[model samples]
Target: MASFVFKVIRNAFGIAEHVAPGLCGRAAFELFCRTPNPRSLTAGEQRAVDQAARFMAEARRHCLTTRKGRITVFDFKPQGGTRPLGTILVLHGWRSRTEYMKSVIEGFRDAGYRVVSLDLPGHGQSSGRRLNMALAVDAVRVAGEWFGPFAAVAGHSFGGAVAVNAAVGAVAGIPPLATARLVLISAPSSMPAIFEDFGRFLNLGPRSQLAVAAEVERVTGRRLEDFVGSVQLATVPIPALVIHAPDDREVSADDAKAFARAGDHVRLFWARGLGHRRILFDPEVVSEAVGFVTARPRLARVN
Candidate 1:
C-alpha cells in the first residue's frame, strides 16, 4: 500500500516535470533532494528511522550550522583509552545518516580510533529539505573545521563523491580540506552518470534532462562535470582506498575502477557478494577499511 502510494506520487511529479521542465524541474529538484525512507535496511524494512536514531545515540551528538545548512554529527571517542590513536570522519550516503554506518563506525571505534559521522544537510537529523552537491561539500568543509586534522576520512555512495570533492577542492572558491587518507566505497565516478541515472529514474525526456542540468548549474555555479570523482582525483595526491562490488547496481563497478585508476596513490578492494550497502556491514571489509585509516605512516610528517 505504501509502495503503491509512493509510485503514484513519483509518477505525478514526473509528469509535472515532463510538462514544464523549467518551473517543475526546479520544484522536483528540491523534492529530489528531500530525504527518503531508507529503502533496504539490513535488519528489516519494517525498522523505523526512529529506531536508527535511538541506536545512533550511543555516540555524542552535535549540531553545527554551516554556510549551506545545519548538520548533525555523531562523535564516538574511544572509551577507556588514554589518547586516541587518530581521528576518522565518516560521511553517509544520500538519504542515509550516521546510524546506518554503525558497522564502519564500530569497527573504527573498536580499533581505538575516534570516529565521527555527520548527517548531511537535508538528510537524517540535519536542517533543511533541499540539498545539492555544492552544499554537501560545504557541510563536509564545516565539519572538517569543527573536528579536524583528521588522519583519514571515509564516505559511501554519494557522500564518497562529496568527500573526493572536498579533498580535491573541486567546488568553486573553496580551499581543499586536508587529510592523511581517504576511503571511497561504492561511489559514482562522474556527475554525468549520476544525472543520467536521475533522468532515467524520472523518465525525463532529453530536453527536460538538459533543462534540469542547466537549472542545477545555475544553482551551484559549477559545471556538473567538474564534480566528478575521477576528474577530481587528478588534483588529489592523498593515499586512498576505493571499494566496490561487481554487483553494485546503483553505482557501477566501473565507476570505482575509473576513480582508482586516476591516481597511482589510490587502491581498489573488491568485496564479492556484499553488493552496495551490504558491503558496509561485511566484517572483512569493515576491518580492512579500519586498518587502512588507522595504519601509521612509515615516513615522518612534512611539518
Candidate 2:
C-alpha cells in the first residue's frame, strides 16, 4: 500500500515536471522539508528512555524563543549538585526528540558535565511542520547565545550536520556557534549528495531537480554546495570526533572518512555493528563521545 502511494506521487511529480516545473518544485521542496512523524520505539530504546526519565524529571526545562518558533530545551546538570566540568549542547537527528538521546545524555551527566539539548525546529516539542539544515543551524545559534560557550556539541545524523554548520559559521547572518569540541555521528558530508539522493528517490528529471535546487537556495539564501560538511569542517578550528558504522545503510561511512581527511583535528571512530540509530545507544560509542568531550585540551591535542 505504501509503495503504491509512493509510486502514484512519483508519477504525479514526473507529470508535473513537464507541465509546471516551478509549481512542482515548490510542492516537492515542501515535502522534502516536512518532518516525519515519530516511530514506535524499539524495546532497547524504550528501556533507555525509561531509565532516563528520572534524570529528565530533575532537569530544568526551558522554552526558548527563536525565529522559527519556541523550542523546548532541557538543561541537565551533574548529579549531587556538584559543579560541572563544562556544558555540552546536544542535538538530535530528524524525526527524533531529546528523549531518544537519553543514553547519550545520561552518559554525559554521569561524566559530570552539564548537558543542554533541544528538539530541532520541527521535531519533538518544537513548533513548525517543516525543517531544513539552515533553520536547524539558526536554532542552534539562538541556543548558543542563551546557554552556550559549550565545551562540546554532540549530534547524531542530521543533527551532526547542524553541529558542523553551527561551528563553521558559513551562513550569511548566523554566527558560528562557540564550542570547544564537536561529535558528529552518522552524518552526511555532502549536501549535494543528499539532494541527489532525494532526486533519485522521487525519480525527478533534470529540470525538476534544478527547480528544487533553486527553491532550496531561495528558502535558505545560500547555494546547496556551500553547505558541504567536509568543506565547512576543514575551516573550523575546533577538534571534532566523527563516529559512523562502516555498514551504516542510511549514511555512508565514506562521509566519515571525508570528515577525518578534512583536518588533522578531526578523529574518526567506527562502530562495527551498531548501524545508524543503534550507534547512539552502544555503551562504547557513548563512552568514546563522553570521553572525547571531557578530555583535557593537552591530551586531546596529543591524541
Candidate 3:
C-alpha cells in the first residue's frame, strides 16, 4: 500500500517535471525541506517523554529569540546539586524532540555536568515549519553565544551535521560554535548525497534535481557540497567522537568512517546491533558518550 502511494507520487512528480521544470523543482525543494510531523510515540517512547517532562520540571527553561524564530532551551543542572564540572550542549535529530534525548541528557547531568539542550527551529517546541542545515547552524551559534564556551557539544542524526557545521564555521556570516569537544552520532557526511537520495526517492529527473539543488543553493547562499561533514570535521581541531551503528539503515556506516578518517582528532565508536535511533538509548553508548564528555582531553582510540 505504501509502495503504491509512493509510486503514484513519484509519477506525479515525473509528469510535472516534464511539464514545468521550474515549478516542479520549486515544489520538490519545498517537499524536500518540509519537516515531517512528529511520529506517534511507542509505549517506550511515551515513557521517555513522560520522564523527560519530569526532568524538565526541575530544569531552568529559556525561550531564546533568533533570526529564524524563538527556540526553547532547557538547562539541566548536575544531579545532587553539585557544582557542575562544565556545561555541555545537546542537539536532537530531525523529526525528534529534546525529550527523545532524555537518556543522553540525564547521563551528562548525572555525571556532574550541566546539560543544555534545545529544539531546533522547526522541531519540538520551537518556532518555524521549515528547516535546513544553515538555519540549524545559526540556531546553534545563537545558543552558543547565549550559553557558550561549552565543555562539549553533542548532537544526533541531522543535529549532528548541524553541530559539525556550526563547530567548523561552514555556514557563512555565522560565527563558529564555541566549544571544546564534539560528538556526532549517525550523521550524514555529505549534504549532496542527501539531496541525491531524496531525488531518487521521489524519482526526480535531471531537470527537477538540478532545479532543487539550485533553489537550495540560493536559499543557503552556499552550495550543498559545502556542508560536507567529514570535510568540516577534518578542520575541527578539537577532540571529537563519532558514534554509529554498523548497520544503520538511515545513514550508511561509511559516513561514520569518513568522519573518523577525517583526522586523528576524531575517533569512531561502532555501536553494533543498535541500528540508528536505538543507539540513543543504549546504556553502553550513553556511558561511552558521557565518559568522553566528562573525561579530561586525550586521544583514545576505540576499536
For each candidate, what is the lDDT? 0.78, 0.85, 0.85
Prediction RMSDs, each to the true structure: 4.9, 2.8, 2.2
Instruction: State TM-scores per candidate.
Output: 0.85, 0.92, 0.92
Model 2 off-target regions past 4 Å?
Answer: 38-51, 296-303
lDDT score of residue 240 within candidate 3: 86
Candidates 1 and 3 compared: the better one by lDDT is 3
Report the lDDT tens digits of candidate 1 across residue range 55-119.
Answer: 57678889998886788888888755647888898998886777778888888888888888998
Task: State the TM-score for model 1.
Answer: 0.85
Q: What does the lDDT come to for candidate 3? A: 0.85
Query: Which is better, 1 or 3, measured by TM-score?
Result: 3
- Any idea what lDDT model 2 has? 0.85
User: Which candidate, 1 or 2, would have the higher TM-score against the true structure?
Assistant: 2
lDDT preference between candidates 1 and 2, better one = 2
lDDT of 2 at 212: 86
User: Ten-residue segment with the worst summed lDDT in candidate 2?
Assistant: 294-303
Which ten contiguous residues of candidate 1 have the minimum total lDDT?
294-303
Clashing pairs in 3: none
Query: What are the per-residue Cα lDDT tens digits for candidate 3 across 3-29?
Result: 899989999989988888878888988
> In angstroms, how far off is 211's CA in candidate 1?
2.3
Kindly report which residue stretches of model 3 are placed more than 4 angstroms away from their true locations once superposed: 1-5, 38-47, 296-303
